[model samples]
Target: MTDFQAIGASRKTANTMELIASAARRTVKAAIPAVPGGIIRTGRNAWRSGKASKVAFLVDGAAYFSALDQALRQARQTIWIVGWDFNPDIRLRPKQSSETLGELLLSLADENPALQIRILVWGMGPVYSGKSLRLFRESGFSSHPQITMRFDLRHPLRGCHHQKLVSIDDSLGLLGGIDLTARRWDEPDHRVSNPVRRSPDGTPYEPVHDMQSMVSGQAASLIGDVARRRWKKATGQKIEPSPVRDAAWPLAVAAEMTDATAAIALTEPGLIGKRGHYEAFRLTRDAIRAARKHIYIETQYLASFGVARELAKRLKEIEGPEIAVLVTKSSHGLIEKLTMGNNRDRLIRRLKRIDRYDRLRVMYAVVPDERGGEKEIVIHSKLMIVDDAFIRIGSSNLNNRSEGLDTECDLAIEAETEGHRQAITALRHRLIAEHLDAAPEDVRQMESEKRSLLETIEVLNCRERGLRHFAVDIAHGGTTPLPGTAIVDPRRPYWPLHRLRLRVGRLVSVFF
Candidate 1:
């Protein structure tokens, strides 16, 4: 089958316009030669992204918030922030700076005459009142002339703009799932109770694990382009890109890879007359198919039917890549429990049944709490590493909303040199080690001894406070999805009778 045919995206009675889009993508795919493995090219499955001169992976909130604080401190011409939410009261560097995010931005605006800061977020930002920033009403964003924050209202019903991006002076870019919000700060050690990990209100929250990346050069400018385009769409004002400047990447933080090819993949629901962008979904599917040795995925939600299908097919193969999937133990709230939680359970059960070769592992992490009981460290990161050759990180979850109903952006990197490959592998090992409470080198040694990631994890996992397989920890969500799953975790935009359509579509994807 042709590559596009191999894609064969599941659909529910696609309209003529969508059909035309598929056909057009097919034509484009036909003209361009199939991209070789490990190389990212603009075609059906990918978009054109700029090359990076330097890249660093920010593992936890400590690293992410610190790098972001330094980059924002260096902002000169322009700063663009886009995200699902932000909390102005959260300090980027709690010990180093006493200023809240709002205070810091205000201070920077007051200091620089040329710098203009713009923040764009989902219209429902206020609904997440306790978590997100009050930029509109109480926060000082409305008072400052140099800084403007706008809540984006342009989306299909129930859909949202959920991208986390920061661009400074068009010279540096920070992108990942880590948001500038309260209850989002935690160290790599993931100590259950750290005095510094409390929120602005001094309330302690759960241990959270997340990922972000800092980059410069053409890649940073391209990321700046992404932020500016969204700014114009949310507000009618056009913001021009600033000229690139010398970005002194923060000290003591090491670069993960230098001089690598990177690209941004987006997931945008079709709104108004615009075509939907599902490149993130397509890229995940293709990445799974292309994997030869191992596929490591860490996500907050694991409820995408499209991605489940891709992974199920791989698990059915006798010689497919060893897949290691890590997800949070439960949904955050009651509403999410019925929708995201139930869907995740059913998918996990189905995959476990198809693991004839025993190449699949679904797990979660836990740490010893101060009270001597184990506490589940929230796996808030959305990242994937395939065979040590490719790495992707961003706000895109493995849920239905992230596939097409919500706006998302993910940074994907293709390892270009020996150093890049080694770095990618080291990153995966380090992250896995965090869960195992073992050293990265120990994880690497275990992997080298056991050819299978499943076997490696089994050997290293401690029964008390490390990674636990889903079957041992989480109860099954039943063979069928719970009622109202489609309403809460929609895969497509709401149309007339969209609820009925979504229910029907779920039935089709799961049973067929």
Candidate 2:
């Protein structure tokens, strides 16, 4: 019986490998119609405008809550939210209202007779355990006539809905790492020592630092399409196009901008039930491959072996562009630090080996205080800027779980014109400025002093070490020495238990 089982396992492995090979060949042969040069040139022309199509940023919990309230109020026809976790009992504005998310959603449904609300959440995770699912059912969302909520179980046995986005009436959208849950609220100040935070039950919660973005125009419409498709997949219902009506929300268009083009990128496994469309991941690879000057990447995790290999390949070419990566240092809670922090170490080791020119540098963002104490500001923003001509912001992290196991959505804008390029550059400076609590102009001046924007801030902030810096150093320094390969070898004897734990972790990562 054992011999028979061994033979069966070997056959299964061979079959899987053959399937993967076939998929690869099909992907290579697939024809992605070339985007016309005229369109590309038009986008290039729009880069001259020194303004983004639409710009809004959300920091901490207050910002997230405010953005959600404003989006719901402004939505005329539809409201769609996708999340890794969704707690109906959590209040959007605990300080102002005692109503939980469920009540608030029901109220929206009651008020907007013509509006449709759809909520998609991860189906198999701690957040969606049996009891939690019961809570969801007990919440008004399950019975609300105008609201539709469903658990997204699209992937194999272990996969998750990890995107956090809210689209309103096809006119406005919010995307980033911020989730609508408890313990996610805090002010931009990120008062570390302060003991004042409001939870849904009026209990105090700890402060957290995070970021999200609000967008409008064509970009919003594109994101809405993504939401609609996912909704259909989960609920088997097609969304009727509901044109945007309310104009009260701030939606700005660049005045002097010219020739700017924006596109959305998504990432998923190679094959999904037949016809191929890993367009998002492919676009990301192509963007990296095409970079001529520099690439600035910001993500929550950096554990994708495939991405690391691609980066190493680019770095090895010598003539390729410089690459800079910004990730969270180790200050996460015990469990998170053990899992994500361990992956960070493995990633750093892989990067070090591939960095032949010493051009690649990884750093953590720190939030400093007046008296010299600092804290590691968690980098929840998923952003990548290439040569000031392209920028991407969304919920996708740079981890194996994100790439192959979980669902994600990202927004990308290419500024081909000088004005648009300048606008994007200014936005990048603004993000850096907010992180440093410095004026935008000050951040801009510091930009030229160092090789990368992250380094510039680190140098300028040398004198202002506080809880933030201490946390960053401690977190980054504590990781075991990196291994040599882009792909972590769980079998290696010297590899830390954390690394081995990650191998065990793969079982659940599909739903993480």
Candidate 3:
């Protein structure tokens, strides 16, 4: 009996120790900022004309990896890759078929000897864990010379490392919606006949539309700093500063200003460790407040608690600028369509209540020519164009997760000069033009005619069903219990008590 009591006491003590350790780990992780300090700022006339920094745009996985490969090949010192997901098996250039990302990093480490490669990826669900996690662990454990990979699990409940960014040697940086993985491959032409793609098995995957940015000068350095801080939080290691080079890209850079100025915006839950990063939400709020003419946005989801309120207020103010939003018609999965989609519709109705359904327009991107008969084109790019001057791109969806429940990093550039503003406007035109399979000039002409983006889309949508109608149907296709209110906490039990709570929450979300 005494031995049994001793054993039970020992077990309790061990459990207490384990809990303490877990709490300590969480505390350390929470200390890390969802949006690092000195990353973003908002002000009146932020986009006013002046001599400012030069910015470039790089989109999708292929373009980003290509730019990284080039920058790494030329790097004199450091490389940083931050992402929600990173696949080691993914060949940066699968068409080249010469090297995988891991091999490339290994070779870089071997050749440079002094160069450091830091990879920060989300510590997502175990089911999503792939070869990258294993390779990262093995490399660290085996004491592989120069490459370092760390998993970011900073936010305990709702946070995720959703930023997709890469700074190469501190000289060049890439930012945007594209993650380094399969199923993300589309060209500027957006051809349907024969598109480039790669499957998990290295076969042909379907085409996807996405965007990214390539930045040089101080912007690159800024991104490098952001990456370093995230790395430190993840691994408790300090990174040395990497300086930028003066080399120029042959292609024209977007947001090329005469002045060297820009800002970085971050998004996550409300609080680090306690909640998530809401940096994106904060940035959007500030941007909306500052807008003078028009606020154009492209995002995956638009169902945030704070954001919806802000939009309603702005739309009702009557003094604020008009707003246009672009989002996916529906999530790819039916379950998401049922849950998230329903929530989105409720949010939309709320926005309409404020704007009286006039100052707001929401549209979805559709593959203009679906010769292959694909039912829908998934809209994945998270971007915003405000007053034809401010541009933002990142991984944050405009939802609860982005507001205060998930990790996200976004880049924002204000076109301070006419040339820079025009360039940014042209890029927006180009993106819309690509989706519509029309020329940029045509898009510009349509916009000049004072057509809502949805109206322009309707005109361009070749299908007899039409774009606006399609968007409406897609937005409406969900179980109408309450839109944007179903909170699925998978950890809960399958008992009737839990189901009752869920049903109650569903009903309450609709009214609240």
Candidate 4:
């Protein structure tokens, strides 16, 4: 036999062997459990399970606040808010309201003398930005005897309270990445330049996109418990649970799932003799590793080295789930550009090299310019949908801080039943449709015809609205961009001394 023929036969044999090995690896992953226990918990907190009578996904601040306004109007016994920052000057209902947040809360409290309103914000947040100080000075909650606001300062060094949650009457809960503050009040329309996207003083800012998950029933009560615990730690006073009333399910938000179970996961730093919890990290990692077909994720920060390593391992398999990550086009500020931007580049570069199946795609959604200037939208959502099996929505970004440094709360719903599966799938399609500027039904129909997600998006995307591939080549030891630019994005809870601390941390990491 000729040498060329022998080589051709040998190549065929190697290809067959590779196929068999890939199939075997998949079988092994499927058979073994990713998370040994059904629940993801840490030393401090246990995973709580409760039923959600109704779960609704609120896309952007406009939808979220509109629904929240209605719910707050119906708040009876108690109204609780926990956030990284609280701005009373920001209008909840921008079109209808002339009053600030403090006025609205005071009015409700005055009307119902028995109703109590409490707010807990991160202590150091106002010091980081002048906007937060304006919120502090302008939010007249102190004058009202019924309203109480406190700063949470019980975290380890460099950690901050980063959970955005609101629970009313222990019957309704709102949780996700959207904070009730300035620069987070845009609608899904996301016009290239909207007159409404401005601060109280009418200073315009770029359009931002974030998500919130609203729930009623036991799940709401569970989240309320979390808030109460936090308030106790910060205030040294325990608050009683509110009486459960008729679930204040928003009539405007169509219920996506009824009587569904929501898994509550938390991230808490170990401090002052209290154990730390990292359930948010564990839950996310397990979900991604268990995905069989597709894993869709939208996040603000992708700086977790552990998560990137896990994803790279999964991508190394010849055949596995297709990974699609939707991220903001750039870091928000100068410090973030140095820390998060550089870290993100390093992570994606590793993934790019390991993606052997051509199945990994990283992109950012853009609102295309009609007059020839594309407007970048900030993607501040922490969400993931795994093969129509489970969905996670919350304030936890995919970063080291969210994993262990900061405090976070996230909600996950597993599709154990047929109804749950359909709901999860529909939610995924709706989000993709929003990004592509197409109807959810169209995305569903195209996907049902066996088209890949990337293919469907490419076919539907036009010049007006679409997802643009985020180039990872720059991440591959390429020339980095200049830091400290106004156009680059900023960080949440921005640290003034980040540059100095970052240099110190890098030096420590090199030796440690």
Candidate 5:
């Protein structure tokens, strides 16, 4: 009961505290999934972990436009929209509201004097589009000085600024492949004969399917940061973030997950060289590589041999998971058809050869025509679902341009528990159901009954609003795109030919 006894007791307490700290560290390490390497990390995705108080996956233009309208109506301080394209005349909510996007923005600015609206759109060449200039001249967007718009031309030659994001009050954001433009508003029916599917000129466009996800809280702040950096880079003018306290989350759209972790990824010119930023590409590859049961992808183009190789490797595994890729039946124009279609065919053949176990299936979604025939529903959505554990939706396509040439942004969410996994699976089912024109519950039931995703799809497919198998004759050595076609669908900026001089320049570029 002297100094010696007291010293011994103090040492014992210290040892116990150290043990507790060590055990805590082990538990924390076990909670988070290990960062994957090899194929995924090799690409170097610019992945930054962020928090989302509320997250919702909105499918198709109907859901996206509706939710966006609701959020815009609630905006208090600022609104920021960054996209590959923008059509001011597009109706924000065709049925619920008669307001067009430009009109809505103007009205919001009028009502809220303190509100600032900034828009950044790609400076597409006339060969691709001149719609942005026409919109500014004809639409009422130019009438409002409070709303600032800029065309983003800051990119490598042949590259485009292809990220589509909308941030409201720096507390709510939406990001994905769907641009707020014309020919992007259709209900889940995806009815080929739908009257609302017509453009501003009353011309009917083909049916299309696309998706965008909304996030609130800290996640929105991170997206706002990205958008501001883009605005600065494109315009060389810095903008301040909004000071809104409450997020403008749409009341009508229910939150899919609360307190979830969301990762923001990017693809930029910086990622092309030795020291690069390839977060979007890396995250995508890693997610596919990490899949254990199934992989579902919806894309507009499939031209990247690197991505194709990764899939082929997985398909060649003895007990590999099933892979389902949904793409548009054909590209829009003749040149696009010749290039994108040819590339798609070549990749499918390569994957088919490695799919000795029949684990890979490729199909194009379709909508029913009024005359009892089926019409192609252009699938422009960039999405990937991996075994109910990971969900990625963004503007980046599974193509070489998106990987190295284009400026792109994407976001991903990884579920950590069984309940979360069920939510992810349900979201996938809902998307597939929308494409198939079947009930989400029905899709879930079919998938449960049949272990194979391809089998479930084969059984549930109907003549009306169904999927059509993609079959192409295996090319002798994979079809190479025609010569001048590269100028149209180039992996880099197209250089104009000036006889011998230009010919020499082109040759040098090809060799380099």
Candidate 6:
């Protein structure tokens, strides 16, 4: 099983809305894998599983953006974009064209009167806009009649709306961690300096690494359904699901896995007469527990205590699966260093201390620079693969907030055939190869020879542009976690909405 926006660009058409689902459904308190223990199951870890005719994984920002732009250019009916952040000014193909994201959508709307473009992002845009340089396009988005944007004030508490998805015409889906914002476009090479990688304002940022998956058929429609529900809740308007009549898969990209069933898991905090759900968290834990050989993870954060506890237990087991975690080691600014960085370091220390079997390896990626040195590439992807048995890709960070505080969604695929298993293993190997600058077949052969993931990596790692294992005493991130960790990385909702409603009503009666 697999587990898994900021703000208004313009205030003219910008409005904030509360997230209150119609019903107060009780939380499904099922254990990891439920009773009999399987990877993907509804009412347990996954909300639903839909069929996919073709699944293609875009490895980096360049591939993903290009394919997305291509798909958006071909859209016919509806466009749904749900993210933690969004920027209408950023260019999808900066080198090839100067058309910004806003212009593209507006142009699409102009082309087809039936087409509707809707974007929903987290309401707390100003909180992250400054640090992340999220563009606030005043004249953008709302300039067109068919293009609309809204802020989703999800949960009555300190939770976030963090799902990242883009669906077109209910036939093609682009689901991943990479948001359509500034400072996120980069090729697989991830050069230390690229003029074309600059933001809309000519500000150069560090190289970024992320992934997105393209799926066609019923699975893509399922993703559209997710976007529709969130849109309806945030804007209080129901949008009909488009029929999968068109061939919507991007023609430039090739599918890696065919005829696969994908499980869509979600995490929603308990609020507004609605019960909390942690299907993403449960799916992740179950996937980890189900691993028999190896577990490879790429995450932006590593501060979830529940996840850490399960990983620690697995590492302590003599015959447990080997784990390899790839994280970013760079400059995210002072605030991040003080908060998320410290929490991550604390978990890193614990994981290191408990990895008795030496089965765990935590590392960062780097690319060769022109100055004869290596510069680390930012790792912002949330991916996990368990010994080719399953693969997951989505927006859920391995942090406390992502477990239940935020609204999260993920797509997981379980290998049901020999070919599926091989494809899963191939993807893992391909990612490793990308990091190490080695060929996928070479990585596969090395692992085959070594019979261990750690050994294979050690054999492939080089002095330049390769993965660097984290030292026992890593720097920058403090050794001890800072105080008020819960404030910054909360694991649950801050306030129950029903309680807030009761208090508000009492106040109104007294005053009015």
The TM-score leader among the candidates is 1
lDDT of 2 at 135: 51
lDDT of 1 by residue, 1-512 (tens): 42212222211222246544544554443333234654455666565688888899999998898888888888889888898887778898887878888888988999998888888777676577554344546546556888877777656667778999999888899999988888888888887868898988888888899999888888888888889877766665677789647767777678888998889888877754568788888888878877778899999999887788878777655456789999999787888887787788888877765554567777788998778788988999999999899899999999988988888988999887999999999999999888888889988999898776766777778546688666532234464466776778888887765455445434432331
Between candidates 3 and 4, the one scoring higher on TM-score is: 4
lDDT tens per residue, model 6, 1-512: 10000111222123222211111121122112322545888888998888999999999888998999999988888899999888787899888999998889888898899898888877664357652223334555565678877777645456678898999999998898888877789987787889898887899988888999889888998899999988776666788888544846777888899999988899887765677778999999988877778999999887777898888767665466899999887537776686777777777877766554467777889998888887889999999998888899998999888998888889999988798888888889999998988999999999999998877887788648788766555333444456887877788766646367435434532331
Please provide TM-scores, in order, for all candidate models, with all chains considered together. 0.87, 0.73, 0.75, 0.86, 0.85, 0.87
- Note the clash tally of each candidate: 1, 30, 24, 5, 7, 5
Pairs of residues clashing in candidate 4:
331-489, 332-489, 332-490, 333-489, 333-490
Please give the ranking of all candidate structures by lDDT, highest first, separated by commas. Answer: 6, 1, 4, 5, 3, 2
Q: Give me candidate 2's TM-score against the actual structure.
A: 0.73
Segments of candidate 6 deviating more than 4 angstroms: 1-37, 130-140, 474-482, 496-512
lDDT of 2 by residue, 1-512 (tens): 33223433554454445554644454342223223332122222121112224656565567777667756766668888888777676767666777777787788788879878888776654254334656555745676778876766554334456778888887777787877765677777666555446555566644456667676666666667778887775555688666663434543322323333456555443223343234445545656765666788778776556677667656654445677677777544664555567666665666655444445656666655557766666666677777787776677777655654456766666766687788777776766666666667877787776645545555444434212321232223433424432233121112343345334434433432
For model 4, the run of ten residues with the poorest summed lDDT: 485-494
Better of 4 and 6 by lDDT: 6
- Listing every candidate in turn, what is its Cα RMSD in Å to the true structure after a full C-alpha superposition? 10.3, 13.1, 17.5, 7.7, 14.6, 12.1
Residues 1-512, candidate 3: write the lDDT tens digits: 33223433554454445554654554454333333332235432121111224566665556666666666666657778898887755666666666776677777778887777777777662236545436535653225667666666544343356788888766577778888765666565544444345555656644456788777767767777778877765555687786535434424233444454556666533321233334466777766656656777777776665667766656654335677677777665665676567667767766654443245666665553556444345567888887677787777677666654455677777665687788777887777676666788987888788555544554555542222322233224332335325354121122444345434433432321
After TM-score superposition, the amount by which residue 463's alpha carbon in candidate 5 deviates from its true location, in angstroms, is: 3.8
Whole-model lDDT values for every prediction? 0.79, 0.60, 0.60, 0.77, 0.77, 0.79
Model 2 residue 292 lDDT? 62
In terms of lDDT, the poorest run of 10 residues in model 6 is 1-10
Q: Measured by TM-score, how close is model 5 to the native structure?
A: 0.85
Residue 447 miss distance in model 5 (angstroms): 1.8
